[model samples]
Target: MMRQRILVVDDEPQIQRFLRPALDAAGFDVETAATAAEAKRLAATRAPDLIVLDLGLPDGDGKTVIETVRAFSSVPIIVLSARDQEIEKIAALDLGADDYVEKPFGIGELLARIRVALRHAEPAGPLPGPEAFGPVVLDRDRRTVTRDDRLIHLTPKEYDLFVLLADNAGRVVTHGTALQRLWGPAHKDDAQYLRVLVGQLRAKLGGEAASLIINEAGVGYRLVTS
Candidate 1:
């Protein structure tokens, strides 16, 4: 069987030192790049199965790398960065990153998220048609969403959260469940992540459609279907 390839892009030598071995031990064929320029070049030539990207690089911002790679590829990207600000996380996710891990992270958690991302990336069997909740519509198969016949752009995480709630429309999706489904078990207690995603989802949804996602307060959220 061909080993799964992973491209690790980070400028920190210490980070490169540890992640390469950890990923290798976890059975990935690992490659490393220390700069955004290098990462873009390797991504073109290496065609890695997934990319572990860092936000700060010597040559340019990691978001640029994401935009560049997303232009030509849908390869899963998991960002590893020291920026723990919610804005940074939201920005990265909105820019096409599949996942984000804050620095001072546990290798185990990162590995688990990697598994979730890779599994989610696989081609699945046929899915049901677009689901409608009022004006918002989500086409699961195409992974596209529309509101009032116009397209609505959602980040990967936002889409996941939307789908989860959409799948259980009119019912409460506890914060823990939503978090785990979108961010893995390790993030079950990280309600802030879900909150930020929901906030962004609401912003793009706009107006009354934004209110479709109801906050349950210290409990979870509900996608009001009616």
Candidate 2:
């Protein structure tokens, strides 16, 4: 089997040196680029399965690399940057990054995030029936949610919110994306509405099942399958 390729875009030699062998040992064919220009060029020409990008690039902002690559491919991009500001994370995510890792990160955590992104990028097979996470089952065809065989009633908006999180289980769904999808573009900035809706949904899900909806704080929420 061909090893999955990872494009590592970072200006710091330390980071490159740190990740190359670790990623290689983890079974990825690794490629490195130090500037935005190089990153974009390699991304287009190399067709890597995934990319680990830094926000601060010598030639330009890393987010632009995300925009440029996203224009042509749906390949997963993970932002590995020192910037931990919420706005920076939101911007990277909204710009199409599959995941974000703050700098000084542990290799183990980064590897886990990479695996999740790759799994999500894989083409999904058609669902055989209702999707179950823990005791909660979401029947998309019937538009119903149930917990331990008992029906759990949800409002239309709440159902939509739940479904969105469920669809991207184990991945953080940014607030901007969620708002824009659940509400219209006009209401995309309305975070309070999302908070209220989540609270309501959590109440309905109840007990340990409600805990499945994990909050990403300033980012958004992720539905934990495990």
**Candidate 1 ranges beyond 4 A from true positions:** 128-226
| Residue lDDT tens for model 2, 177-213 | 9999999899899999899999999999999998999
Task: Choose the strongest candidate by lDDT.
Answer: 2
Q: How would you encode candidate 1's per-residue C-alpha lDDT over 122-206 as one tens digit per residue?
A: 8766786887888898898789999999999888888888888876565456666678788889987798888888899999999
Q: Provide the global lDDT of candidate 2 against the true structure.
A: 0.93
* Each model's lDDT: 0.84, 0.93
RMSD of 1: 11.9
TM-score for predicted model 2 compared with the true structure: 0.93
- In candidate 2, list every pair of residues with a backbone clash: none
